[model samples]
Target: YMQKVAVINSLEEDMKALPDEALAAKTSEFRGRLQKGESLDDILPEAFAVVREASRRVLNMRHYDVQLIGGMVLHVGAVAEMQTGEGKTLVATLPAYLNALEGKGVHVVTVNDYLAKRDCEWMGKLYQFLGVSVAVIQEGFSQKRKRAAFNADITYLTANSLGFTFLQDTSTVDRKDDLVRLAITRPFNYAIVDEADSLLIDDCRNPLIISDEPDTGATERFLLAHKVKTERVLRLGHYVIDRKLHRISLTRDGMLRGRPPNINDLWEAAVPMGPYIITALRARELHRRDVNYIVREGEVKIVNTSTGRIMPTSRWTDDLHQAIEAQEYPEVEIKGRTKVSSSITFQTLFKYYSKLSGMTGTAITEEEEFHEVYGLSVTAVPTHKPRRRIDHEPRVFLTENHMLRTLRLLLTKARSQLRPVLIGTASVADSEYAAANLRAWGIQHQMLNARPQYIRREAKIIAQAGVPGLITIATNMAGRGTDIILGGNPKGLAQLALENTVLPAMAAEGLHQQLVSSLPLAQKSWPKFAQLFPRLKAVVDAKLGAHDTSEGPDVKDAGGLLVLVLSMQESERVAKQLRGRAGRQGDPGETFTLVDLNDPLVEAAGLTSGMEAARPFLQSARRYSCLPELSSLTQDAVERTSGM
Candidate 1:
């Protein structure tokens, strides 16, 4: 690593000396070498140097030596565990450029469509400056647009899109012309997944499937099951539910009561009613309103458990989705399921890539999983500055209500100090409840969740979260990609302008006014910003106007941003991602995790503990029990499932 950095550093001085035209010409020259049979490794040093110079000139952000090391780690097909503010997005450019030279697309996979679009527009500027084409894959794009995006030198997309596209291609068996619309233009060449742990480990179990034509019989069965009222089923003792496991079984009496006429036939055939009962049970007991999903436009949308984003295209397999629609919007059509024409797990899909790498704020805990599944290892990239975020010991309570009360008090205290607080909740319901509590106290704050409406506004919400006395509540989706700037985000002025209109002149003038009056930036920071973004500057007498450099710091004296985590995620890595939002780029900040024993993670942990404690007793009983094999097998299964 040191040797590679040394070579890259040696070329930087020479590359910086080139004129703008000369620097721009270098991209073509590098392409020429690659076309002439030179490996990416052969041009690594100079190519990285060129990118470094380009970023400095274009974005005014210089790649640190550590970032260069991270870039190299990614280029070699490894996970670079860089911290929250280490500019992993910029580090991607090095490898992205090198790999894109091969003319087979390099995919920069993000956690969601919002990030995919944000990064493509943000980083596409840098790549476009270096003569590389970029495109984004998002929902609602036409087939032609998707093909165009996939054909780009570097395409930014969610892992779901990439997986679904692959599945779609598999369904196309007709002819060569038909394949054009279904296929992703490039082969599975090189991919750099953002939030690697969330995508590769936490969400790996679910397979991507393209359904065949809807089965009307299955739809009828779902409709019939939906007609059986929940209260009637419970009152009649027709179903037994295991709340913790989210499973339901039909009791003998209940089975007889609700059993279809062809119960015996269902035993041997693919029973639609069996799945209907399970799905109904799960929808009623396991999936809570707003907590697990939200009702929007009379449709049931699956909330991404890890990110707190609404996934409109995603649906439960079997009859689970229709079961949900049946329960939520009884008047709407109960969509029937198609046969799974094609399917692939993320584990299997990622394996098709010629080369794979990933970057995330946290990955060490799942290091073994990464290596075992993707043949990738994690490397902790050193931060540009020493971390100063104070992580307080977690506080535990007996119930969620008690925790909420304590959380309210903490928010009140943080508000008094004028420190912007970001509270990370586990679900949309939890975040909504937090918002409600804050509102009851008349606390002014912003709420972000997985609702479709909030997805587009996420970038701005997160960006300005660090301003004085701002209380922003969000789900895990806000944890990655977005950066929480200390005091204020100056760039947000430009973003706001662009969002308001597409006209460049209007945006530039509008951004100037917002920067001068609206931002909470320190007076000293303005001149530096004006110089960095000359196009957005409104000058007077060869100097920035007095209004441009007059704003005072809003919350710098309040100890910067404070992060509050309301509940624990299933993985410690995810918890770390939330805490990471507070202390960024060595900024002074603090974070605390308040836990309730009723939280899913806490409940799971307790269950694991109970299972472990009972293991020896089960073993002892097995020695004398007639069903020794079954007992031993149950013990082993418990150990494995509990990760003991």
Candidate 2:
């Protein structure tokens, strides 16, 4: 860790010493180096130094050597696990500075309208300082606005926003009518994903495509008509399941019912209850929702689940969205939508970068996944100060009911401890259940999950989470990019304390005594012993601007923030992300759950069967039984799922 600090400090000095001419010239040298088939590693230091200095001259902001090193890692295409508040935005300047010279343009992808605009205005300074023009894309921007932005040397845009625009751009009758349409020929340049994991991985499974079709009533009629007919058939199960093929076939007895002509004409391929039939029905019955997806006028508008913003321009292609809407609103028009063009998959999108690398606090365990999927390995960046987080493992249960009872008990225990606990739930339904149960038990907790607004308000809740006796019920994923400190939140003191040095006298101060003790030895070495340490003062005064502040007062006492997760999520990926929420950057944190037969993933994966066998013996300890130490079982499940 100290060596890393030394390297960072050295790089900062090197950047400060270089002259503009000498620094800007590094771009040419690196380009030449690349042309000669030299390794990026060979030119990384000089290349990074050049961009670092260039950003200073161009944007008046100099990169910390750590940022330069981060840029180097990105240039080599790896995941740099930089912590929050480490200037990840400025860090990209090194590489964006290098890649922009290729003249292909670079795509800086963000999560929402807010981030896109914010990053451009903020991070754009570095690019502009370095002689690169920056443009931002937001929803509802005119074609001219989009064109001007995309034409810039570096274009910042939201992942879905850009994708949807790409689709709309291509569908325009005249190419000259829009900017994205104009840039259609520019080829996708380097794309730097902000919150890379969400846009690139969590959303990878969905395709971004452009579709075109002549609107007709025939398609609309089919949707309404099918919904009416299938509604009855589904309950009856017109087909019997073969299970072996995971297929449902039309039963001999049910086939005898004469097929209705209207339904037959619209869906000749859809035999009710068969795989195709079920899929078409499921698409309508389960896919689209007014809350998550709204049908405005005649078109389907996909809601941004993470942000809760209305994606007005987002549409369902090839009739899927329309089909689902038809089931929900039988009276609405069900228009035919067709796919016109597409380029997707998280792997393919990130691969477009000539050089790709990023810092995320949560990438070590996913190093292999990153390598396998995006061909990027993970490199851990030590924190400036030793982490002092504390987390605990789940206490398991035999049944969902038992898990609930155990949770109530745990919640009671947590409230008694006065060590604010954050409970992560697997579903919206689960969140509601927990909320109701907690309320019944006289527990006061804040709920945050899939609601789009909740994510935007992440800092607010996390900021308040440290208040002793506060309980926050969050979605399993709500913990990302946010840290929980111990000894309850020192309301309004975080920004000042975290960044500035804490003084001995300040440490001895009454209200903050508990907080100062939570600091590591290195943290306690700062200059003053005044009323407030510089770090604490800095944290308190830090201008978080529009972005959420992570600065929290350090606290001492029993285990830090208590993290209580109800069930393990479906993907091991989620399980990893959950554990990651705690113990950030070597913080002393513990994470535990009450896992048993009640969790859906366990049942789906057959772990519940094993629990069933062990149920009787573990009755008295029902709700607190931890997941048994079954190595062979875990290994078998992992392999089986891998094969699947």
Candidate 3:
């Protein structure tokens, strides 16, 4: 890899000397070489050099040596475990452009629609400048639009969208127009999965299912089961829950107790009462509101556990969705159960590609899974600069209140230094809990989670999350794709200013609401807006200027973004990802974790029992408290269990 980087660097000056037109012409030139039987490896160095130079010209961002190595790792169809903020996005352009020369399509899979669109628009400029056609596949895209996107040289989409599209195309359609036609027409060529661990490992358990035939009379049974579980069954006395396995079962006493009035009717209708009761119990005990899913406009929406984003089109399978709905809104009309027509897991979906590669900060932990499942090796790419982030010892508290109190003190200290703090909570409910405490403490902060309002303004909130003295509480991995620029992102600030100031004024003047409503559309029509309303440009420019001149240096001096993890995640990878948010591009930062002994992770790992077993020993050793050591042990155990 170093030798290849050297060769690529050797061609950098020559590539730089070429004009924009000539640099872009290299795309066609490479295609001609490939047509003449030259392999991608034969042209790798020049191609990388071309991409590096084009990036410098178009995006004004040059790929560092380490990033070039990361690109090479991807081009060879391996996972490049690059640290966060190490220019993984730019590293992708190299292999994507190189592979697209075959005209066989390159798919860049992101975690969600927001990232798919964001990366397409952001990196599409570089690809387009190099004369490579790029498109993004969104959930609401028409079939024709999807066909066009798939036909593009490079396409960006989520793993769910890709898997579902493949499933939809295989539905034995009678007419061509009725089909997505993606799998039938487009070849499964090279794929680059961003956040590889989340997609490949964390999300592999969830298969993409397309269901159609609705089962009648199931809603009543589900509602009855939910009512029985909530009103009759006690958790400890009537049922037992295995949090790690996500299983719940009724106790002998509960089974011996009288059944619900409609239980016989449900059994006669072919719906087993035991399964319904167990499903209802699981829904009530395991699926938490605002944690596992959210109630938006009176509808239950499943939240993606890995990304902490709402999967708007996703639902629980096998009557699980109806059970949750029944548990949440018993009075409302519950949707009927649907039979699975077709389904595909992410593991099977990615395996369909001819060549697969991925980039993530946390793939090393699951490298064995990658190699075993996908036949891909994990390569750790060095960061451009040394990581200066300080990871403090975990502080364990016996109670949640004590943990919150310590968190408050830490936030106060961060505020005193005018340092930005990112509070990473395990779930939306936890984030809200932190938010309520912050509000009571008179602390101003932004909360980003699966809530409807936060979803729309995510970009803006993450943009200012790193501004000096600003506090942002986000669920798990809320802003995974977008970088929280240390000082404040100037472009993001300007966009925020336009949305806050200019767009409202445009609406007041009776301008087309759609034109001003959508940020991208508004940006496209900005020149006209500037001509008609001169103040709009002034407002945006002022914001850009002020952000450019202020706060960033102070933030750096005070130390970069401080990441405060309220609780340890089930997997150490997620905890590391949260810490990765800070100290980007070698910036100085610190990470501190406060663990509640009663946290679900602790309970799930059976650490609570272990701690109890050592309680007497801990009490005797007054001079040396091992609470922190025990907390670390708990985290290790959780990570081990998660890997299993």
Candidate 4:
């Protein structure tokens, strides 16, 4: 890797001396060489050098030595476990550009639509400057647009979107348009899956399904079962719940107890009631609003547990969807009553790719699975600088109130130091809970979650999360694909200022001024808006031109962004991701985990017994100033015993 980096660096000066047009012509030159039977590896150094120079000229960014190593790993079809804040997004451009030289389509798979769009637009500048055609596939795109996008040299899309498109194409028997057929016929040559751990491991249990015809009389059965479970009183021993496996089953006595009172034929009705009753029980016990799913526009939307983003088009299988609907809004009509027509697991879907590579900060833990299942090796790329993040010992609290108290104190201290704070919660409800407490304490903060209102402003909120003395509460959505600079994101702030202040004022001066003047912000600033607009525009432009190095002296002096984990996630990788948010790219930062004894993970992992066993020791150690060591010991014990 070092030798390759040296070779690439040796050619950098020559590439830099080329004019913009000549730099871009290198793409055509590389393609010509490929057509003459030259292998990609033979021209790898020059290709990487060309990309690095193009990036520096177009995006004002250059790839580091480690990032070049990461690109090489991905080009050879392996997983690159690069740490957060190491510019993984920029690293991807290397292999993506090199592979696109062959004219075989390169697909960059993201975890969500927001990232797909963001990466496409942000990196499209560099790719286009190099004369490489880049496009993005998003929801609501027409077939013709999709065909054009798929035909481009490079495309950005979510893994779910790609899988569903493949499923739709496979199920299409009679095509009416050439565009649809062409789009469906495109080959999956090379795929780069971002957030590899979340897609390949955390979400591997659920398969992507396309539903077909609705089941007859299934809605009524679901409603009846939900009514019996909620309205009727039942004994505690009626049903059994396995939290580990997320399964629910009813005993013989529970079956008798769940039946309708007016049903006279016991044996005849009981046979049909078993499935519905069990499904309803599972929905009630396992599924939760604001956690597993959320109600939007009178529909139940499934939330990806790992990423904390709403899966708008995804639905629960079996009768689980109907049961949840019946449980949430019993009076409303139950929709999405359909059966599975075709399905494909992510493992099976990615196997169709001729070359598969991935990048994530937490793939080392799943190294064995990656090699055994996908035949991919995991390589950990060294960071450009030594990591300076300080990880404090985990703190355990016996009560939620005590935990909140400590959190309040920490926030106060962070505010005093003028440090930015990022609080990670386990779910939307937890985020709101933290927000409510922050409000009570009179602390100004931003909240990011799966809620519809927050989803649209996700990019804006995350962009300014690192501003001095600001606190941001987020779920798993902020864990991946986010870069929180130590000071602030100049470009994002400038964009927001333009959109909120400048654009509306400019639009208001036209014939539609009445419509624009009615807005609250525009109305308040309209008196001197014209005179102030120019100054605001100048500032916005100046900020936009400045690069984000995240080296604010005051911010660094305050110890960078402080990450507080309010609860332990199901996967330790997620907790690591949250911690990884701070100390990015060798920045100074600190992270501490405060776990409540009653946290869902605690109960789910069966750690309540262990906590009880160590409770006395923990309390005694707290008085002696040995709490940190004791807490670390307890945490290690739990991790070892639970196999997390």
Candidate 5:
């Protein structure tokens, strides 16, 4: 794949040897070709050639062969499944340029504000070099700045920010006046969604709704979410010794109103009026504070079950978060009103991507889900280097105690070897648990999760993850655009790293001398490629973020990162991400998981193959406990009535 992709990109590089005037003309020629009803596929070679030359001129950055292949996929309305550390930022340029030709605005969707603005500033030079307008949409931008960005040929924005704009567009007091929509009728066009999995899968269940105002009405969803209702909780009994909190139960009155009377009536168990419950939340089901939620601004904030950060955007619907909150403090302030912003689930949002495609190193495992849900297909993009991580089968233990104890042994072995450690956890609580336990073991470490002062803190911690014997506990952080450097490990370990990881940039810079040598004696207008070649060299020279090459104590030298998998995952893709942090680019690293049967998802959904696991958990809960008895019936009624 690398050889083939490289050959193709080389041909594009050849085109840049022409005069500057001729080089600029490629943009017009490509657009003209598109205007003449040429398919993007028909224009692929020339269109890519055009971008290749222009990126050289503008950003002084050249696309690698694989990056170009990923770009080609994007231009053709497909996701490019490139690995992390590959230049996705650059890959986007090929398609962004091609799509912009239609004169319909292109929206480059990022997972967060940091990326949105960063890309616009970093890659915007290339777009501007090609004479295409570019802008980034971040949170809390002034109306004018946002409007200017939207007016550009290409606007970069986060999913939530863009969704907020769509909602704001609808509620604009004047029908003809709005910044988000220049036409006031035009919806957004092509979007290259970064962190596609998080948006398309993880967030799919939560639907998006835009209302003129906040919905103050007490819907069960808001009033009953575990995060929100948890604030008013009064604990009647202490939980199991080690755990801070316990399973939630229903109050007597709640049981009377909520639980179905005939929980065993499988036929009619779904009756809405039953004592059947979601919380079954007795007045005194065991509850804990640090593990579940944290008090912020006198208000209870629900922790993201996966990341252990305060879910500022999430609200308890039907007393779920709130129910959990009520369990925490008897007097946590009530989240009385919720305004439905423009909200859409990942499932629904992806379906709207005029043309849908995405790339992830781990998407193949979720092929069935993608196909079944979105009618999308996954194509394996071969990695430039063979993966060399030492993957051990999940080490399942009977209890959390056993799992932690085994983990200590593993940590001791790695620490002895001076291996750098990166522990991937499932949720915030899990990350915390691992961090707390490691601290107890006299192991100092850093944590990156839902910390409020997000940016500087995260960057500071991640920088040293590549160092030997340095331990860092994180959630899905390393899997996404994160890089771990060698931090100057021992000779033996560094050699293993070189053997495992594929540093294409390092390879490219070596070619730089050849590039200079290859320059024609009678120089043509190869200015763009000349400019880009050096920048490409710089990108390689640039520290891969936290994977710095600094040669000192601040560099935090360590062996390969030892990933402590503290939490269990339901999906293969998730487990892959956790493990993906190690052995990136074929780097030698190790991954191991400590699975405790008591994890909530395992407890709620049960351990089995996807659908089978879900079925048994649901059926057994229905049989043994009294929860979800009425949920089945009510959901049917709602689905039937709403035609959803």
Candidate 6:
């Protein structure tokens, strides 16, 4: 890696010698060489150096030596496990530019539409500066727009969008007009999957299905039971829950209890309501509101457990979604129609790409899975700076309420010091619940979860989370390509200023002037702020703030950013990703895990009996025991017993 960085660096001086106009010519030269059948490897150093220079000029950000190495790894088709805040988005430019020279399309896949648009626009400047055409594909994009995006030199989009697009292209008839409408004319030459582990492994079990018709009969099965309150049915002790597999069934005695008392006549009137009742029971017990899903606008949206984000296009198989919808709102109409015309897992879908590489903060924990499943090797790229985030040992509680109380206390203390706090819950409901408790305590906070239409503001919420004294509640915090800077993001502020304003430079200039006049101190604090204001650089740079420019030290003095894990996720990689939000790029931060016996992780682990056996080694009480060693212990037990 050092040698590669050194080689790339060696060409920096030569690239710097070229004038602004010559830089564009250099890109055409690279393309010409590629047309003549020159390998990308032969021009790797020069191409990377060119991108590095372009980034410095266009975005005013220089690529670190480690970032160059990371880019090289991806270009060679390997997963680079760079730590959080190491600038993965910028690193992609090197490879993205190098490969685009081939005139073949390069797709940069992120976890969501927010990242897709944000990265495309944020990094698009550098690519455009280097003479590469860039386009973004979001979830609701029209076919014409999608075709345009797919034809670009470098396209940015979510993995799900890419998969659906690929499926659409494949299923369409191979004709000229059909090809234009279905798009994806180019072959799957290369793909860089951001947050690889979460997309490739954690979500591999659930296949993406394209259905034509729903099963109307399945909806009728749950009708008899749906009329009766789900809470009442759950009150009976007839169901047995296999928490490990997330499956539930009726106990023999409960089965003998026969049809529910209030709903017995309704059950007899229907054609075998037993299975539907069982399904409803499973939805009530296993699928939780806010955790497994959220009731948004009176509809049930399945939450991706791995990412703690809503899978808008995903629906539960076996009529579970309708069952959940019926349970949530008995009066609301339930639409149940299902015929799966096509389906494929990430494991199967990504195989079509000629080259697959990925980058994430927590890929090493699932290194084996990456290699075995995707044929992608993991390379642990050294961070640009040593990580300084302090991760405290787990604080295990006997019950969830106790943990919530402790969390409230922690937030109160952190806010008093003006430190930013980001609480990462395992699901949408958990985040909302935590936010509610904080609100009850009179603490102000913003929440980032997978709610309907929440994707639009997700980037802004995450970007502002690092402001001093700000407390933000989020789900998973995995595969969110946006970086949480220790201090506030100045560029984001500039972008926000341009959001609602007119496109003309004069209008943007007027808004920028208004913004700077209101916050004159921003100029000194953010050296790049003048870039947003254009020709007003000289006037803005003359004035200085009352205090020092950077907010990093002030945040550090107040304890930097604090990450609170309200619940444990199933994957250690995800937990690591959450903790990674802090101490990024050597920034001072702290993380703590406050878990309880009621958490899905603890319940899934089946560790209560194990806790009893290991009581002598734990901090015990009469009612419950503290498994401070919960993570590794529970993971081991779950793997042994459940093979999950």
Candidate with top lDDT is: 4
Per-residue lDDT of 162-273 in model 3, one digit per residue for the tens? Answer: 8877877777463355444544367699999999998888887788888887776787778778777777745577788887678887777776442686454333445568
Q: Candidate 2 residues 52-86, lDDT tens each? A: 65666666767665565666666666777776445
Model 5 lDDT per residue over 1-644, tens place: 34545555667746778777777677778788887889777777667777787777767777766677787676656656666556677888888887887777788887667668778887887777677889888788766677778778888887767666655665674465644443223456777877666666666686545534444343343334333224433233311222113344444544433423234431253334221134424322433454445566666665544333454555655445544544444566444445554566657655655766666666665667777887666666556567767776555444567668788888888778667778887655567878889989998777876646543465456656676677788866555656565563233233334323434445656754554576454135446644756653344344333244443233333335567776655455666766777766556667876655465444433332333445455545534222233334332332232211
TM-score of each: 0.83, 0.69, 0.92, 0.92, 0.70, 0.86
> The CA-based lDDT of model 6 is what?
0.77
lDDT, model 1, position 435: 88
Stretch of 10 with least lDDT, candidate 5? 235-244
Total clashing pairs for each candidate? 2, 48, 0, 0, 76, 7
| Residue-by-residue lDDT tens digits, candidate 6, 468-488 | 889998887433565787666
Question: What lDDT score belongs to each candidate, Candidate 1 first?
Answer: 0.77, 0.59, 0.83, 0.85, 0.60, 0.77
Give the better candidate number (3 or 5) by lDDT: 3
Candidate 1 Cα outliers beyond 4 Å, as residue runs: 173-183, 227-229, 233-246, 256-274, 399-401, 493-556, 607-644
Candidate 3 ranges with C-alpha deviation above 4 Å: 173-184, 262-271, 511-542, 545-549, 609-644
Lowest summed lDDT across 10 adjacent residues in model 1 is found at 539-548
Q: What's the CA error at residue 147 for candidate 6, in Å?
A: 1.2
Give the per-residue lDDT of model 1 (tens digit) for 257-365: 5555546532455654666765776677677878777888777788877777777777787677888877775645667777876788888898989999999988987
**Which residue pairs in candidate 4 collide?**
none
Q: Give the C-alpha lDDT of model 3.
A: 0.83
The residue ranges of model 4 lying beyond 4 angstroms of the native Cα positions read: 174-182, 264-271, 330-332, 511-537, 541-551, 609-633, 640-644
Clashing pairs in 6: 213-337, 213-338, 213-339, 214-337, 214-338, 215-338, 290-429
Task: For model 3, name the residue pairs that clash.
Answer: none
